[model samples]
Target: AQSVTQLDSQVPVFEEAPVELRCNYSSSVSVYLFWYVQYPNQGLQLLLKYLSGSTLVKGINGFEAEFNKSQTSFHLRKPSVHISDTAEYFCAVHEGSQGNLIFGKGTKLSVKP
Candidate 1:
């Protein structure tokens, strides 16, 4: 079984400041990782993904994540954030065989001016 854990439930940051949302996963077998962002009153959108090859993955809205195999971590980071960046971010892992994804509770990013 594969599971995801988001370290923080909420992250408050001022506009233009950097932010990092921590995500950790536990899996017995190899899996695919993904980060999804859900803005207010919107459906989940793919922020980034790590299917294979490169460890560093970049996504929309100036967000990027590094896949650390040894630590089982795939933390999302943004060099700077805007007020529009406020949203709920979810970490998910795909269990290869079933092609099902297990998601974390999510981390709310509140970008204030």
Candidate 2:
């Protein structure tokens, strides 16, 4: 089985400040990893994904994350964030054949201006 855990339930940062969102996962088999962002009253959008490649993966809006196999972690980072980046972030895994996602409770990012 595969499961994900997000360390922080919320992170409030000022505009243009650096931020890091912690995430960890456990799986007996191989799995696809993904991070999605959901703004208020809007659907989720793909932030970034780690299929199989270099440990470092970059996504839209200047966000990036590194996959650490030893720690079983995939932590998101941004050098600087904006007020518009405020949203709910979910760390997910797709280790099943049906392609259903197992999402973490969620990390709320509150970007203050």
Candidate 3:
């Protein structure tokens, strides 16, 4: 069994301010982690992923995440955020392969001026 918790329903941050979106996952076996961002009416975009090897993974839009296997946590972070960065973020996990997948409710990021 696998599940995801976003921890926050919403995150507010000023433009150019650093932001971090916390995510925690639980699973019975090894799984792949991913962070996806969905703007307005667009489809979900791959933010970053943690498969193996490096603990730190970088993605588009200057975003990065560190994979912590001990704690089973993979939190996404951005040094500086822009106004356009406002969107809905989702943390997902694929158990073993891409067959069984679980996703968090979502965390809406509101970037103010």
Cα lDDT, all candidates: 0.95, 0.93, 0.92
**Pairs with backbone N, CA or C atoms under 3 Å apart (clashes), candidate 2:** none
Candidate 3: tens digits of C-alpha lDDT, residues 23-43: 999976777999999999999
How displaced is residue 54 in candidate 2, in Å? 0.4
Best of the candidates, lDDT = 1
Per-residue lDDT value at 105 in model 2: 86
Better of 1 and 3 by lDDT: 1
Q: Where does candidate 2 stray beyond 4 Å?
A: none
Question: Lowest summed-lDDT stretch of 10 residues in model 2?
Answer: 26-35
- Write candidate 1's Cα lDDT for 14-113 as tens digits: 9999999999999867779999999999999999999899999999989999999999999999999999999999999987667788999999999999
User: Pairs clashing in candidate 3?
Assistant: none
Q: Is candidate 1 or candidate 2 better by lDDT?
A: 1
